[model samples]
Structure formats: structure tokens, C-alpha cells
Target: MDKSDITLERLRSFVRVAERGSLSAVARELGVGQSTITRHLRELETALGVPLLNRTTRRVSMTDEGARYYANCLQILRLVEQAGDEARATRGAPAGTIRISCTAAIGVLHVTRLIFAFQDRHPDIGIDLSLTDERVDLVREGVDVALRLGPLTDSSMKLRNLGHSRRLLVAAPDYLAAHGRPAAPQDLSGHEGIRMTNVAGSDTLVLQGPDGARHTVPFGGRFRVDHGLAAREALAAGRGIGSAHRWLVDDLLSAGRLEVILPDYVPLSVPLNMLIVPQRTGIARVRLLVDFLAERIRAIPGIEQTR
Candidate 1:
């Protein structure tokens, strides 16, 4: 086997193809032609003296040897990338792409603007932002950091607690005028309830009173949504009353499009956290973005810092 013939390019192509299970898909992802991907695989296999992939017309599967090699390659590539990151970090100007993951609603409503500002400060740095509500594996996805809402499940990734995201029950002024404003927690069930389909027990509204009381009220309505932005829109349209993160509807509230109902009561706050891949903690660009985001996110309208 010719070890010298095995290059980073070949390893990267092999890794992408193995993960995607489609040579053509990997080709498009890498912005290269299928022929080039095929050649990379061929050369890699020749250099290793092993058949790496079992390719048929429909799909590609990794050989046992390929699977083992793929795992090792992931570590090797990560180390190489880490070395590059550290080297760049030591220079005068930090430069490299930072991959970030965030929930779609916050990404669109707030985080994107912060990212734009971050770019303004560091022109050489590039950002690859993935907007999704699903929890993604940062290492598997090659993400540098992720801004996550609610409680987290994974213990492997490093954590930075941003704070609890404060929430409130709100309705449009037009809706209030048509349906009558809810005077208290009991009055909420009589009015339409715009609940989240994604959240567990969203049909039940839990509010903490200013007097240190917890109110559990049955909540339901004609409109149920999974996305935060959708919930904000529904509230603005006066479809129903629902809980919204303060950051999600601050503008509408300020504009009088949406009004807070039951001012004495507040919905349960969700935890907002930043998760970083263990290997990326020391990278300068990652650290810069992480610190920048933490500071900016805390300064947001309804983000309450935790002790």
C-alpha cells in the first residue's frame, strides 16, 4: 500500500460518500463532479490495498474495513482541522469557517442578525449556519457550536448556559376586542388557545403568579403550531392566545400588534444553552463566535441569566 498516495482530499471524499451513501450526492456537496469522487475512492482504495465501499446501482455501502477506516479518518481529519484552527488562531487575524446550528425561528428572527454583525467585526471569518429545531450531533454534523433551547439530553458535548428564555401569554388586540380579554388564568380556557404541537402538554398552560402561586389551566384552540415563528404569527393574526418567547414577539408587542394577557401571570421559561463540540473548544474563531453570541443573546429582551 502506498501511504503517500492517500491524501486529505481522498479521505474527505471517502468520508462524505460513506456518510451520504451516494457518490453523486457527495459530488454535489463537495462541488465536484461524480467522476472526481469516483477517482478519489479508487485511489484511496488502491493506496490502502482494501476495498472500501460496496457500490451498486442504487446505493453504496461501506465494507467492514471501510467502516473502521472511516471512523479513524474522522478522528484524523478532526485533528488536522484542529491543528489548522490553532495555527490560524495564533496569527494576528483569526480566519476560518465556523459551523453553527440553531432553531429555525430564533435563527431567522434574531441570530442571523447577530451573525451578520459578527461578520462585520471579522471579515475573514465565514459562517455555515444550519437552522433546524431537531437536535443534531455536533461532531457528526461537523458543527462548531449550537444554540439550543429547552433542556439538553447529550452530556458528551461541552455546555455554556446562556439563560432561561422568558415567555408570556399574548393575543392580538383585534382578537381581544372580538373575543374579550382574559381577566385571569380561568378566563383563558374560555378564549381560544393557540398551543404548540411540538411541546409536550402544550394543551395545558402553566403560569407562575406574582404572589408565588402556580396556575395550571387547560389550554386548547383551533390553531396548533410546532414552530415558534408560526406561533408568533398566529398570535399576531389574533387566531388564539398562546405562549411566546419574549424575543419572538417583542417587536409585535412594541408595535401593539400583540398584547400581553394576564400580566400578573407568566409561562414557564425555557432554558437556552450553547453546546460546543469537545474538540472545537480551543479554536479561536469558535471561541470568538461563542463569546460574541453569549453576550448578545443575554442582552436580548427576555433572556434572563441564570446564577
Candidate 2:
């Protein structure tokens, strides 16, 4: 078969199998039999006259040729998507599935409501929201847009600053009353500090002290929770003073369930960002999601009011 005869369906199947690392997984996603996926991969490899994937009983991985071909395929797919987007743009309404990944707190407090409202406005557009605290690989995860907080280390992705969120040190009022408030960042050493673990097993906490000096406190605790909601609940129950996104604690603070400690020492503000993979940014669904998120996040009262 001629190389030009390789159909987009075959390319898509090959990419999916490579990304998911399993033909069975791809079959599950595509709602087809595993043998169908294998046939597509075989046809694609035959057309290209290259061994694209090393298939073994234990695992599946891309060969060097497969890696190079997959990269080119992604570019071609993105261009095709952009062409479709250009066609759709003239219709004056955005449509198609927008896959978004975001942290749990932002997903719960903001993204969910915003997506609902967006769907109401643009009924033609479909949203696929994935909420996790783990840092996702946009391309590998098949995400069109990602809502990320704090510093962005991925130079390959395009980042648009949504706004800033304050990292606050907070404790339940009862806990503060009994243990006394931390007057300084150093005082935290004397108190029970609740720590949150990310997917990579790293802990992050920021403290601002009476002297207006910022300190990033990395600590080990008797309890290490992975979810923001769990940490917030523990803090509310006086388990320990913990650090949280200001918006996450807004209701609790207003209800006097939690109180800010060392108000003068607030951690350095972290900017919330919307990121898109460079190759996919021009795609209609991806562009639409990024624009929608940027506008919605900018309008959030909690994020907007933060200095």
C-alpha cells in the first residue's frame, strides 16, 4: 500500500495504542474489539513499511521509528483539527468535545460550575472534565486544556495566566484557642502541621510571618493526606494547622470554622494558569476551552480579589 493510502483512522488507532500502551485499553476506549485495533496497527505498519511498535506479552512500547512517526502524526492530526476549527469558526458557534484536566480544588470550587454555565451558553460544545491533583501530560493524557495553579515548569506548553491565589495558613478556631496562634513562621514548628502529598510524593506549604518574610515550610506529619478536601476537613476538625488555597477555605473562614494564622505572613502569591499543548492550541475545541477557562477564571470573585 502507498504511504498516502494510510487512512486517518489507522493513524488515530496507532496513536491511541501507543499513548495508552495497550491495544486492549484502546479497544475499550474506541468500543471495539482488541483484534480490530491490532489489525489497524498492522495495516498502518505495512503501509509505512516500518515497525512502529514493539509488542510483547508483558507490555507494548514504541520503537524509534514509531516514535518519529507518532510525532509527525500528531502534527498532522493537529493541522487537520485546525482546518476543521477554521471551518467551524465561520459558523459562529463552537462545537465538539473539549477535554480538560485540573486540580481537585479548582475543579470542585470553580471548573464544575463554570463548565455547566459554559455548556448552557454554548450548548453545541461537549465537555470532558478530568479532576486530579496530579500533574498531567497534556499530549499523553489527551487533554485539550489544563487548569494549573502555582509555577509552571513545562516549557513546551503554552501558559496563560488566569490569576493569583493566596496560600494561607489556617487552623480551626477551637484548635487555635487551645494551642494559641502562631505569631511567626517559626512558631509552626511547635504546632501540629498537616501535610498534603501530591502524586509524586512531594509536600508543599508556604508561610508568611510577622516580619513579612515568606518561608516555604516542608514538613513531615503524623498524617499525610493526598486530597485537598481531606486536608481541609482535618484542619476544620482541629487536626492541625494546614496550608490551603484561600478560595478553598473561604466558606470555612466566614463560618469561623477556620482562622488564618500569622495574617501578616502570607506565602508568595501563586498564579493560576491555563495551559494548552503547543501542537493542539490551534484546534477549535482546544482554543474554545482555553478561552472559556481564561474568561471564567478571571471573573471568579475569590481569585480576582486576591492581591
Candidate 3:
């Protein structure tokens, strides 16, 4: 028989005999009889074309050839162990491509940065991101992970709380200085406002004032956009006083390009969540990406910290 036909059982028996130096001792450890151990060793020796052991009635030892063969077997066994470890490591690590979807505004403001950080840590992992304002079916679209804002409607998908973002009424410093800032929620009626439409085509703004009273402001603008990013760009260009997630305009606010119109009347913080299909929960790549994004989103400036 060729070397490929040699059985691991025979190699194990030879190693046991070489280590114990006695057929009876090796057989005892292997849970086999002494004759059985001798037969296995003979089979291995026959396959290798080399006598592997020096056998005697009083004692057993390795011949010169047997010593060399045992040395080779030891090296092979060590290599086998190393190969098994590498396989296990690949299975546990995040190494596959993950599909993700998010709104254009959030994607540009937050998700894009997190994706870059995740890629830096796991270079082997590929990320496919689809940015749109439309509500996408996670399973139908074949998305592995999704970043969603506000309340979620689909109960079938698994949701993990990432953090929360406050909707702030903001305007360009020039616009606010020219038209003057609204002193109260009711004052927005006389001021020019910008509105964003969701998939449902309805728009509503809710705010919580310093007096601990919740105010729902209902208004329509001369200009309406379907995406937050477009609405933010319009607001930055001095279109009108627009409301957007605080996280999205953090840089603009910090640089004095945009100013919070109503500081005392801040809107309610909307929960931001990471949604994943239930079937993908156990997948190593999906789980790793979800966890990494959750931690990073929570650290974003102006967003509520998650516990």
C-alpha cells in the first residue's frame, strides 16, 4: 500500500509504543491487548518499509530506524494540531462580507465613519452599504445589518438599541440673524420652516420645552425634501429654519455655520437602533459588525449615550 493508505491509528500506536517502551503498557493506555498493539506497529512498519521498534521478551526499545520514524511522526502530529487551531480561528473571526443599509443622512454623518473603523480592524471583511431614504425590507433586500432611526415598525427583525439622537431646530447664522430666532414653539408659525417627508408622506415635529411640556408643531414648508441630507443641505444654504438630528449637524453647529433656533425647546430624543434579520444572529460576521457599530454610534457627539 502507498503512504496515503497508512492509517492514523497505526501512527498513534507507534507513538504510544515509542513513548512507553513496552507493548503491554502502550496497549493498556490504548485500551487494547498487547498483541493488538504489536499487530498495529507491524502494520505501520510494513507500510513504511522500516522496522519501527526493537522488541524483546524482557523489554522493548526503538531501533535506529525506529528513532528516526518516531521523530518524523512527532513533527507531523504537531503540524496537525497547528492546522486544527488555524481552522478554528478562521471560523470564530469576522472574515466575510456583510451587507448593510441606512438612510443617506445617517450614513454620511455616522455610519460611514464606523464602517471605516471596522474595516481598519478587520481588513478581510468586506462591507456593502446602500444609502437610501426609502424603507427597505431587511430580508427581502438581503441586508445583513441596517441602521434605523426613530421607532421601528417591523417586529420580525431583531433590534439592538444603539443610542438616541435629538431633533434640533436649526438655521444658518445669517438666516437666524436676518429673520430673528423663535422665542417659543408657537413662534415657528410666523417664521419660514423647512420640512422633510418620510416614506409615509406626512411630516410632524415634536419638541420638549424647559417647562417640561411636550409641544407638537404642525407646519408645512414651501420646499419639501424626501431625505434628511437634502433637507440639511437646504438648511445650511439658508433655505429656512429646519429640524434635523443633532448628530448630523454637529460639525456645522460647532463651526458657527448653523445655530440652534430654539435652545430652551429641544425635541424629544429619538432612539437609534441597529436592526438585523433574526436568521443572521448566530453568524460571526454579522454579530461582530452589529456589536462594533453599536459601540461606535453610542460614542457620537450630541447623541445620547447608551448603557
Model 1: pairs clashing at backbone N, Cα or C within 3 Å: none
Best by TM-score: 1
Clashing pairs in 3: none
> Cα deviation of 6 in candidate 1 (Å)?
0.5
What does candidate 2 score on TM? 0.87
lDDT against true structure, model 1: 0.90
Question: lDDT of all the models against the reference?
Answer: 0.90, 0.80, 0.78
The residue-by-residue lDDT of candidate 2 on 225-260, one tens digit each, is 888888888999998888777878888999989998
Assess the local accuracy of residue 284 in candidate 3 as a C-alpha lDDT between 0 and 100: 63
Tell me the tens digit of each residue's lDDT in model 3 across 150-185.
Answer: 778999999888778877889998888788888888
- How high is each candidate's TM-score? 0.90, 0.87, 0.68
* Residue ranges of candidate 3 with Cα displaced over 4 Å: 1-93, 199-204
Query: By lDDT, is 1 or 2 better?
Result: 1
Question: Count of backbone clashes for each model?
Answer: 0, 2, 0
